[model samples]
Target: MAPLSHYLVLSGILFTIGVMGVLVRRNAIVVFMSIEIMLNAVNISLIAFDRYLGQHDGQIFSFMVMAVAAAEVSVGLAIVIAMFRNKPTINLDEFNLMKW
Candidate 1:
């Protein structure tokens, strides 16, 4: 079995990559995917700790986080679609309609 440290390391890497994606990408959809990546990283850590500590709390929190992530995805996608319909592009830089 993999060590807890290994799981944590992997989770950190995934979270870093997700942060980089969110920071470097200009497309709204790509940024949204990056956010999901970050959420999954948290889930990985939650499951890892749950395993290491022999408790169900972490697992329960992980489930809650998954639910929240799902809701976020649904609402975020709806907003993105609306923005696309209004302006025909999903570029964050171009989404300056509210700045006027």
Candidate 2:
């Protein structure tokens, strides 16, 4: 099996990319995807550490994260769809639903 450091490095790279995507992208969908990538990166690290330590705690926490991510996706997409129906664009800058 690969070393823990290798998995950590890969997770770090993926997290960095996800952060860049969230910061640089303008589209809501892309932002959501970036968020997913970030979550997955965290999951990878959690599982890697769990394996390295011969424990299941990290794996169980990762599962909880996945569940939360799934719930977030459902609600987030619903909001996005409603906003798109009202504005016809998914650009982050164009969304000011709370503006008066």
Candidate 3:
């Protein structure tokens, strides 16, 4: 069995990649994907810790995170589609929806 530290390192690497994607990418879809990756990274860490501690709390919290991610995906895609219909582009830089 792999050590807990290995799992933690992998999770950290995945999280770092996700953060970089979110920061460096301009497409809304890519950003959403990155967010999902970040969420999964967190889930991995939670499960790892749960296994290490022999408790179910981490698994339960991971499920909650998944549920929230699902909701976020639905709402976020809807908003993206609406914005694309109006402007024909999904570039984050082109969006000024909140600007007056």
lDDT of 3 by residue, 6-85 (tens): 99999999999999999999999999999999999999999999999999999999999999999999999999998888
Model 3, backbone clash pairs (residues 3+ apart or across chains), number = 0
The prediction achieving the highest lDDT against the true structure is: 2
Q: Each candidate: what lDDT?
A: 0.95, 0.97, 0.96
Residue 90 of model 1, lDDT score? 83
Ranking by TM-score: 3, 1, 2
**Candidate 1 on 3-99: residue-level lDDT in tens?**
9999999999999999999999999999999999999999999999999999999999999999999999999999998878878988899866597
Single out the weakest 10-residue window by summed lDDT for candidate 1: 91-100
Q: In candidate 1, residue 31 scores what lDDT? A: 97
TM-score for each model: 0.94, 0.94, 0.94
After TM-score superposition, the amount by which residue 79's alpha carbon in candidate 2 deviates from its true location, in angstroms, is 0.5
Instruction: Give the range where candidate 2 is weakest over 10 consecutive residues by summed lDDT.
Output: 91-100
State model 1's lDDT: 0.95
Question: Against the true structure, candidate 2 has what lDDT?
Answer: 0.97
Q: After superposition, how far is residue 33 of candidate 3 from its true place, in Å?
A: 0.2
Q: lDDT score, residue 71, model 3? A: 98
- Candidate 1, pairs of clashing residues: none
